[model samples]
Target: MNAQFFGGPYDGLSLATAEVNRYGRVVSKRFKGQRVHFVLLPPLADWERVRAGEVDSAPKHPYELVKTGDNVAFHDADVNERFNEILRAPEEA
Candidate 1:
């Protein structure tokens, strides 16, 4: 399972996937010569539904690399808004 980042320092980068069944596991690794601290978010409440292809799509981000006092912190991603944003249409200029 690969992870994708959006609208942050790691935007457009694909990183290794963490254990989807487990949450709050801090993992340290390097990307592009820079050290990064991050963790995988908890699986959705209805992950079974997702796996069954019931939802429109799976989460684009299953983890987050939040910044905390000069170091990266593992935390839950804002999945609700992200889903809405995905369903929303872009406004015309």
Candidate 2:
């Protein structure tokens, strides 16, 4: 007998599916219990643009942006301690 387990680029990556609604909002519950959110950050090269107000900051939306719960992939890590730094709570700052 043989068996194969599902795999992805990274442990943080997963599969999910969602349905798009009006206003271009995709509603889904792939992260129902986890409450994961999606964040849209500007490109690193946009530093000057951002400082000049040309580039906008990440949108307020990220969580539950999708629901398909399929074909979605992500990766998480603590590279250079940067990830932990970002994970720090607001009050901790």
Candidate 3:
């Protein structure tokens, strides 16, 4: 799977490609050709904040693209059921 973050007046949009590897691993790769940019975080900072009761952000996986009237809302599910399914699938050898 390819995942990429797009920014501009339209930010926070991500593009991804999903594929199953010969070893049966579902892989996602960022669309590097799009040249999208994303914010980077310190690896351990999230864990520390979570333990400190300051991790109030939603999980960053399994997001849904919702369209309502003239507006679009991105919703992230608590658990990534779809992503899990892809990961668990057996790849073609």
Looking at candidate 1, what is the lDDT of residue 18?
Answer: 47
For model 1, the superposed segments whose C-alpha errors exceed 4 Å read: 1-23, 46-61, 68-93
| Better model by lDDT: candidate 1 vs candidate 3 | 1
Of 2 and 3, the candidate ranking higher by lDDT: 3
Question: Candidates ranked by TM-score, best first?
Answer: 1, 2, 3
Candidate 3 local Cα displacement, residue 67, angstroms: 0.5
Between prediction 1 and prediction 2, which has the larger lDDT? 1
Q: What clash count does candidate 1 reach? A: 0
Model 2, span 19-87: residue lDDT tens:
112111322222223434332223335434655777564422222222344433322222243224344
Cα lDDT, all candidates: 0.43, 0.30, 0.33
Query: What does candidate 3 score on TM?
Result: 0.25
Q: How many residue pairs clash in each candidate?
A: 0, 15, 9
lDDT of 1 by residue, 1-93 (tens): 445555433355444444333323444455445554545332445445654656533333434555546543333344445323422434322
Ranking of all candidate structures by their lDDT, best first: 1, 3, 2
Tally clashes: model 3.
Answer: 9
